[model samples]
Target: MAVITGGTRGIGLATARLLAAEGADVVLVSRNADEAVRVADDVARTTGRRVLGLAANTTDDAAVGAMADAVERDMGGAHILVNCAAEPAGQKAVPAPSEAQWASLASHMDTKVMGYLRCARALLPGMRRAGWGRIINVSGLGARRTGDVVGTIRNVAVVALAKNLADELAGTGIAVTTVHPGLTRTEKVDAMLEARAKAEGHSTAEVEASMTQNLLMGRLPTAEDVAQVIAFLASPLSVTVNGVAIDVGGGVRGSINY
Candidate 1:
């Protein structure tokens, strides 16, 4: 089974559905209990597989522990974890942010970086006991380039955290990896595209075209595209790839896949 944080919406939700379709029982972790339950039911119906939603604030230790306990009791145990919880990166594009800006950045770290750690710590004991597990931390392409300071720091931190976890658990049959998605076509991206189009006085199609021009594939990768990669990495098939970050960006310009 898989426990996917932030699984009520966007990439996390998509990943949960994909995993369920692939024959894995899934638990969708979210802060909103109602929304989580609603989406879980929808995904379970559509995929015809076992899927559940457990509400927990990832930043809260007691809440995370309770969620893990529920997962163990309801689904037997989590063999995979996909950490995708974080507040959306804000709109401020300041290269050199002020103190107030740093505070905003710090919130991202607290949620994206430390929140991931909380979930990992809570669920890892069960995984170690099972003697096989996969942890896929969702970072972003901002880790590869330098533009948004907050995005850079948060995403890079996730990569570092995943690598450390993977190495530390290397001999225990558990693999930890990170996936960096770039310009994925999700609801959030759609809203950003609409806003940019309005601001630029261009059609949404035009704005989308410009935004995707930098990608070698000439289009943004869909959420499912990224989700499939995560599901693969979360499965036994991912035994070979560990302690590394995999980019699912459809070949962003100047990106060297070493």
Candidate 2:
């Protein structure tokens, strides 16, 4: 069984779908219970994989605890847990933020960092009992790039947390890893592009073209692009790739010399 947080939309949704395609039973968690159920059913029907959808606000402790219970009750308690739910509200740079900005930044750590730990705390016991498990965190390239201040902080937080947690579980049967995916075309991107178009006096398509041209692949990646890598990591073949940072950006290089 696979439990994916923020599994109702964006990259989270795509990762869930990819796992289902690979024949893993999936349980996707998100704040919108209705959306989760609807999407899970659709994916179950389309991919022929058993899927569970549970409503959860990962930032809330009760919600995260309840989510683990729901998974145990509905989807066999998860043999795999994917921390894909991220708070992107703080994607903008500083100096433009408002008084309520801390909530936005705090929310990211609450959900992506501490929230992920809560899930791990609840689910790792079960996984350890099973003697096999996979925990994949979906942090983005922006975490290391730092061009976008807020994102870099959030991404870096998850990366550090993942590394620390993986070390703690070094000898366990479960494998923990992080995936850094580059620009992917999603609804969020479309909305951003639309906003950019209006602000820059250009069309959405034109803005999208410009954005894609700057990417290494000369095209924006789809949720499917990153999801494929996730499926591979969850596979048995990648058992030895623990505590590692894998990039799924189609050769998108950053400023780092390494």
Candidate 3:
């Protein structure tokens, strides 16, 4: 079974759907109980697979623990964990950031960095008992580029956390990895495009074109595109690929990551 935090939308929801279609039961977790249950029912109906919607705030230790316990009791324990519960990044306006603006960094860290750790801690014992598991951290490309201080720090921290966990779990049949998705097409894209179009006095299509002009693929990846990579990493086929960051950005022009 797979437990996907932030599974009500975007990449998390996409991954849950894909995994369920592949015959694995799924638990969709989000802070909103109603939305979580609604989405889970929708996916379950579509895929004809068992899907449970769970409510928990990853930043709360007790809540995360309770979530894990509930999953074990309900689904017979989860063998896959996808940490995608962070707030959307790149929201901070950082032009000579004020002290007040700087304070938001801690909240980002608490959600993406420490929150990922908390979920992993709660689930690792069950994974160890099974002697096989997949832990995939849904980080972002902000870790590679600059400009977004909160995004960069929290994403980089996730990479570091995954690497350390991968090393610590070596020879234990559990793999931990991080995936960095660039500006992918998700539910938020339409509103974002509309706002950008209004700001620039251009058509939404034009604004979207400008955004993807530099991408080698000439288009933004859809949430499903990124989820395909996550599904692979969550599978036994990815046993040899651990502790590394995979970029699902559809290729950034003139920037090479070695």
If scored against the real structure, what TM-score would every candidate get? 0.94, 0.89, 0.95
Best by TM-score: 3
lDDT of 2 by residue, 1-258 (tens): 999988988888898888898889999888898999999999999999989889888777788888888788877777888898877643565544233367766776787788888888888878888888889989888776745555677878877888888888888878888998787777888788899999999998789778776567767778888888888888788877888788776665454434
- Stretches of candidate 1 above 4 Å error? 95-100, 198-201
Better of 1 and 3 by lDDT: 3
Tally clashes: model 3. 0
Q: After best superposition, candidate 2 residue 94: deviation in angstroms?
A: 4.0
lDDT of each: 0.89, 0.82, 0.93
Report how far residue 10 has shifted in candidate 3, in Å: 0.5
TM-score of 3: 0.95
Winner on TM-score (1 vs 3): 3
Q: Could you give the candidate ranking by TM-score, starting with the highest?
A: 3, 1, 2
lDDT of 1 by residue, 1-258 (tens): 899999988899889989999999999999999999999999999999899988999878899999999998999989899999988865555565343376777788889999999999888998999999999999998898876778888999999999999889989999999999987889988888899899999998898788888888888888999999998999888779999999998887776767
Collision pairs in model 1? none
In the order shown, the candidates' Cα RMSDs to the true structure are: 1.6, 2.6, 1.5
